[model samples]
Every structure is written in structure tokens, then in C-alpha cells.
Target: MQVKHGFIGFGNLAKAVYQGLKEEEEIEFAYFARSRKEADIPYYGRMEDLTAFADVIWLMVKPQDLSAVLEQLKTCDRAGKTIVSPAAGRNIAFIERYLGKEQLVVRIMPNLAMAYRKSVTAFATNQPENENATEIFGLLGKLGKAVQLEENGFDLFTAVFGSGPAFILSFIQIFKEKMQEFNLPGPLLDELLLELTQGTTLYFAQNQKKHSIEELIRNITSKGGTTQAGLDYFRTHEIGKHFEGILDAARKRSEEMSKNGD
Candidate 1:
């Protein structure tokens, strides 16, 4: 039998999930949103209609918009439907507060890389053994690295997995900005940066099994070389600790959202 997946909000994350799974066999898609989006799938204006149509419902609204969406969801006949949420900082317990403990709530932390099936996702569910929840977990395996984790781990997971891509890109931007002395066009500079990142990633992929990350760095750093000079400054300025603060800030915000229900 085909599984019907309904999105409660057709935002970027919802679209990424759709793009990731649309070509899969025996899966149907639909969505309910306050405003109609550009997607080609069937649109349900009413939450009741969407709730009735889907076997699995993805709650795709923002964390701040989650409460209002849940208020509408509570009025719908949601029996036999699995609820999946990717909203950062929100936990299964916060969802259960509206739909109750019996409803299977799957919480996931995934980045926009979901569209490319390369996302590193963190998964947790209110019901671990339930076949439906397990099925959802298996479905996540198709998207990327899906690790089952406790709810308490979600804040760090969100900071690292969900927000990590942007942080990496921000660092890349620093390199791009510094390379303006080359007088290269912006697009060419971006392309060069892409090659650099891809090449570095490929090198890591090829040698990661044999070498630790520190060993990998040491391999690139010759004695008193340019790379060594940069590394010296990086350590002296505690740049790594400053970068860690970015992750810490994201995690703290997630915890605050959980406590404040936002």
C-alpha cells in the first residue's frame, strides 16, 4: 500500500523533504498551509482535510508558529497518523502536550541538505518500538545519516546538524572575501572556493579511516610553514573556541525555545 505524506506547512524544509522523497515508489504527497505555495502537489486548505488524507504528517512550520499550528491540529481527527516535526528546539513532549502521549511523534534535526539526500539527521520518537515510528526512522535512513537519539540530546544535535551548514558556509565566505586581492570576478571566486571545499572533503573521505582529524592537519602542516604560521595564530587567538561559541549560542536558543514553548 502507498504511504500518504502530508505537510502541515509548505515551507523550504517541507519542499526539501518533498524533493528528497517525491521519486520514491508507493508514496503520495499533499500539503495544508495558510497560503498556497508553488509546489505541484495537491493542496488542502483545511487542516481536517489534510489530517484525513495523510498516513504521516510532517509538521513543517517554524518554532514560533508551531503552537498555533498545533492548536488547529488538535481539533482534527488525527487517529492512526504519525506526526513528524523538524522544527528546531521543539521536543516530542511539547508536541505530546497537544496530541497526547498515544500519538506517535517523531522529532528530527536535519539541514537543508535533505534535498540532496546528504543531511546528517538526528531522530527521536515518543514510541520507539511502534512499527509506524520505526518505519519513519527507516525512511529517514534514505535521506542521510539518521541516528536515533534521546530528546535531551536534540539541542546539541540541532545546533550541530541543523545549523552546521550555514556556519561552514560563513567560514567559506571569509576566504572568499579575503581573496578579493586577486581581482577575480565574484562568480569565479565562488567556484574556486567550491573546488577547495570539495577537494578538502574528498581528501578527508579518502583518509578518514586511517587518520584522526589532528593527524590530517599535521600532515598538511610542514615545520615552520605557511600553514603552521596560520595554525599558530589560530591557536593563539583561540579562534576554535570562538567558533564553538557559535554552536553554544544556537544550542542555548533551542533550549530557550523548548522552555518558552516558542
Candidate 2:
């Protein structure tokens, strides 16, 4: 039998998964949204209706929004049901505190790549040794990589991998602008950048060879080459330091939000 899935908030990530599983042969869902339009699937206006239909619920609301949703959820029956939270900064303990001790909760940090059904999601359940953890992991495995992590490790994952795509895109945008600044023709520049990134990514995926990524960079860089010239320019401008500062700020904000943080 297909498991009944439910969502508390119907945001982008929720919609991504909904679209991914909506036509699946073994999955079905109904969701809860503030307004009917907010949900991509059939939705109920009342939490009670959603609660009764769901065997596993995905909580997608903001950290601040969690409290009110918890209050409302407390009025419904949650025993034996699994509650999965994909919100950043919130943890299993917080869910247990707000929902109840009996709630079977899991926390995940799935990147936006899930929109394309390709995500590297980090998952952590409240109890590391729980028997049901395997079942939970298997279910999520269909969506993408579902690596089980210690709950404490979630924060670190959030700071790094969860926010990694944005960081990479920021760098890519700078590279794009640099191409324009050099008066490279637009179409040719676009093609070069696209192949530069896509081919490099494909090469790494195919090889998975013995060397570390830094070692791979060393292999490509020759003495006084164009790549070395660009590397020198970034080094001179303290690009590494700038990246550290950017990630540090992201990590700090995540910490703040986890503790009643916005």
C-alpha cells in the first residue's frame, strides 16, 4: 500500500517533492497550507483533516512559524505518526518539545536541487539507534542520497552543504561578469562558461579517482599558465578570506535561528 504523505507548509521545497512523488506508483499525498492556493496538491484548510490522513508529515514552515503550527498540531492526534522537518536551524528536540515526546521526528537539510529530483540531502533522526530509522532512510532514498548523520552534525551540514549551491552560484556570477568586462562576445562567453563548468563537473563525476580535489586543481595548473594567472588575481584580492567571511556569517545566522532564531 502506498504511504500517505502530508505537508504542513507548501513552499518551494515542498512543491519540489510533491511534484516528484505525485505520479509515483507507491506514493500519495494531501497537504495543509494557509490558503488552498499555497499547496500544489489537494489541501485541507484544517490541520485535523490533514493529520487524520497522513502517516508521515513533512513540516516545511519557517522557524518562527513552527510555534503556532505546533500549538495547532497539539490539538490533533499524532501518536505513531512520523513528522519530518526540513526547516533549517530547527532540530528534533525542538519538535519534541513543541509537538510532544511521542512524536517520531526527523530533521533534514535537502538542497534546492531536489526540484530536479537530484539532491544530496542530509538526514538525522532524534534517536540514532532507533529501529525505524532504516525504514525512514529507505523511503527518502528514492528521492536522492539519504545519508544518516548524527543530530549534532546537522548544524555543520546546514552551514556548508545546505548553503553550498548559493555560494557556487555567486562565484559563477562573478566569473560571468569578468567575461563581459574583458569584452568577450556574449554568446561565445556563455558557451565557454557553460562548458567550463559542466564539463569539469562531468569529468570529476566520471573519474572519482584517487586524488583530492585540491590535487586535481594542482594537476591542471601549469607554471605561468592562464589558469595560474587567474588564480593569482583571486589570491591577491584575498578571495579565500572573503569566502570564509561569507560562510561564517551564514553559519552564525543558522545558529541564531536554531535557538528561537529568525
Best by TM-score: 1
- Tell how far residue 148 is off in model 1, in angstroms: 0.5
- Candidate 1 lDDT, 1-262, residue by residue in tens: 8999999999999999999898998899999998899999999999999999999999999999999999999999998899999988788888999999999999999988889898999999888889999998888888888999998999999989899999999999999999999999999999999999999999999999999999999999999999999999999999999999999999999899888876
What are the lDDT figures for the candidates, one per model? 0.93, 0.81
What is every candidate's alpha-carbon RMSD to the true fold? 0.8, 2.4
Report the C-alpha lDDT of model 2 over 198-220, residue by residue, as the tens digit: 99898787666876887777778
Q: Which runs in model 2 stand beyond 4 Å of their true positions?
A: 38-40, 128-132, 181-192
Error of 1 at 44 (Å): 1.0
Cα displacement (Å) at residue 78, model 1: 0.9
User: Clashing residue pairs, candidate 1?
Assistant: none
Query: What is the number of backbone collisions in each predicted candidate, taken in the order shown?
Result: 0, 1
